[model samples]
Target: MNSLNSPWAAHFIQTGAGNNQSFEQAGALTLENIKTLFAECDKPYSGLPPSALKKAIYSSDLSQVQPLEKVIEQTNRLIAKNSIMVQHPHCIAHLHTPPLISSVMAEFYIAALNQSMDSWDQASSATFLEQFIVDWLVQTFSLGADADGVFTSGGTQSNLMGLLLARDWFANTHSQHNIQQDGLPEYGHKMRIICSDKSHFTVQKSASLMGLGERAVVCVKTNQQGQMDIDELQQTIEALTAQDLLPIAVVATAGTTDHGAIDDLHGIVTLCRQYGLWSHIDGAYGGALMLSEKHKYRLKGIESADSVSVDFHKLFYQTISCGALLVKDKSNFSSLLYHADYLNREGDELPNLVDKSIATTKRFDALKMFMTLKSVGAQTLGEMYDKLIELSAQVADSVKENDHFELCCEPLLSTVLFRLSSHYQGSLSSGEFNQLHQTLRLQLLTSGDAVIAETKVNGKLYLKFTLLNPCLTLSDFDSLFAKIESHAKLLTNKAL
Candidate 1:
């Protein structure tokens, strides 16, 4: 049989060959299907219960081959329809951001090209483009002339890279021990990483993954504003020294998860320098502020960090799974460097990105940022983030003025933490109060009215509004607050 007559011929994307019309048809059909899906859903979520959603998705038959249209129709019915709408004004539950249109377009090209960033031969242009993006990021953050970076999956991977390098660098410098060639050194058990109590959980997770237990992370108490307490950090370091334990690195958070608090980077770096420790800044959320002329001062000392993690998916409004880990000295990447003779051959003049990355077959995610930067310049993106920050402050002020709500703290970035007031709580017990907040958040979500975040602060439950959408206005939030009030009343009446 002629290969062109086979059933599989039309399914694969082909270029510069016979009968390429299927590619165009498939692209059009898929895009139209997506547009229809978006237009059909009015709410941020379908409000489907978990079991029902699961069963509906699982019912699809993957055993049989289906036409593109049939598969897309099923996806619309079972999957896309029920997914959370991050672009919705009420959908401000997490660090998730609605991707920029430019980045979305770049995603299409990224997937279509299917370039393996590991080797120059597989992705000649892509490899160089990623290097350019990494170089630009290093320069933009003022990571010094000797600094370099590599894109990763997201914050978790980036944070791991930072901690991994810190551990290896410390081992090599202190005892002339090579962690890559050999296992962990004898003092590895005593090595410690210090961060604020409000730091992202990845810091502890990274330590455990690096063979150091969670106990290796000594969390200094945060201040009232949720910033890392500089004095407490110094005290903790001195105490660790007194105990003869080795403190390898200090992980400072630029924007905490719940409170959006940025630690005192300058103070933390100063302490790190005094104590002769490596400094890493986890700027996965607030790192975008470097582009903001108005708020860049918040991350003043980030440039001096021994390593830094920046996620483009958060405040930068890029697509998900886009992040970079930067190091002050390019030599730090030696910890993860390797020469795969078949891929990144030694003495090859061409650059192979996998040497600086933990991932080998990485997507061309750098193109998304590159396209976004080119289409909408950094200043515009910074202004969009600035608008969100301004909106968060407005929401905080409004919450303070409301009689039914209790404001937690002044938002340093775009997250507003608050809870129902005692007046609204009435005679409910401590447990009841916590349950009420939790129930209120769920009721709103399950009803598809809003998607607010719920978190615990000092053992007390609180509602969070991670205001990531710059297009949202005070009126939109006012409407959402009215819905929240109504939901709380309904839940409270039921409990009573």
Candidate 2:
């Protein structure tokens, strides 16, 4: 037998290929196992450490069949042992939530089909489905008739695609497409991108990857609430033009990472139109909130953007790696088109995803969102956001009332920043306040009872809570704080 052909793979496959009775027995056994596992994991929600996983029972040789089987069993045991239970009411760390159950089941079929989405010939209906979804999203956001876009791995990739498209669009119009093939030659002026200071660092990184140095991303000052200051932005643009620099694009953040603060899209859009600069919205975190009838006004001018990036995984209750970029003009995608004699037709009538994206192979991310949308509709998702916003307001009010914690900033979207008030004194130096903030976050994570995020506000570190889950309540934070208090005491004792 070839050493590469391991019997362990055969054994695993054989286990999956089962009779009706075998499935019944397996189902019964799995339920029993899950129940027992949940019981052991229920109390304390989580712990510092459970126990080191049992050592591998297999030898190094690939030909060792029985020992390899034992190793597989041990690995499965460990995977089934612990559950983060993000769906449970207790979880409140990163931006996460209980995904739609239907999408979870659809993923199995998507995986089995293994369709290549680069070309219509490769995927047929799958390719059309992806295009239709992108089209639908454009319509939903009210992007103009010129709107078009492509799916990406996530926000980072989506941001990169936006910058790449803007570069191609600008250069093509300015120099008759010289940069695409000849590269930047006889460049008339240095290019620059304007974005809020609160914008994600990914914007700067994307610029760097696109041959635009990090210095190309100019950070416009934001207001106290983290919203971009329109006046400051206008002044910056004017200053750049005065220096004979080419202003390529203005990136407006729909929901900032730390605070969920949405910049004034209307103001940014007006400025972009007035200056003839490309306008792109990095809405990967908050763009989906457009579904909310109540909170939709927060992102009023998003429909006017030249391009928009949205992440379905963040607030749509979908699995990760589902992100999309929307462009107001489909022709802009032509700038990314490539031809391979073996892969694509010379004049393909059908929409090829690869023509519009930086990636050659794309996942069926639309299926999950499609299943979720069809089953429940967008309005339900909107209601979920409304509920979360209301819950966050309640949490903020509670934080304000509590003498122990201080609300560092008002609730923006679904995140709140607060820190311990116990450390506050009649007069304390900024250095001392910063130390207290660091100590508080360290205490929470080390305790493992609850995990809270932290961020800086006006140079002071403050604990941040991102309320992505609609099901969580203020009572949940009450429970979270009780654990924090206990952990803080333990940490303080150790420090003493």
TM agreement with the true structure for every prediction: 0.98, 0.88
Give per-residue CA lDDT, model 1, range 1-496, as digits (tens): 9667888888777655667787887788888988887777678888998788888778767898887778877777778888899988889899999999999999999988999989899998998899999999999999899999999999999999999999998998899999999989988999999999999999999999999999999999987678998888999999998999999999999999989999999889988888889999999999999999999998999999999999999988889879999999999898788877798776889888888888988989999999999999999999998899998999999999998899988999999999998876778898899999998998889878889899888988999999888889999989889999999888887877
For candidate 2, give the lDDT of residue 193: 91
The C-alpha RMSD of each candidate to the native structure, in angstroms, is 1.3, 4.1
Question: All candidates' lDDT scores?
Answer: 0.90, 0.78
Mark the 10 consecutive residues where model 1 has the least summed lDDT: 11-20
- Off-target runs (Cα >4 Å) in candidate 1 are 1-6
Clashing pairs in model 2, backbone N/Cα/C closer than 3 A: 146-328, 146-329, 147-328
lDDT, model 2: 0.78
Query: Candidate 2: TM-score?
Result: 0.88
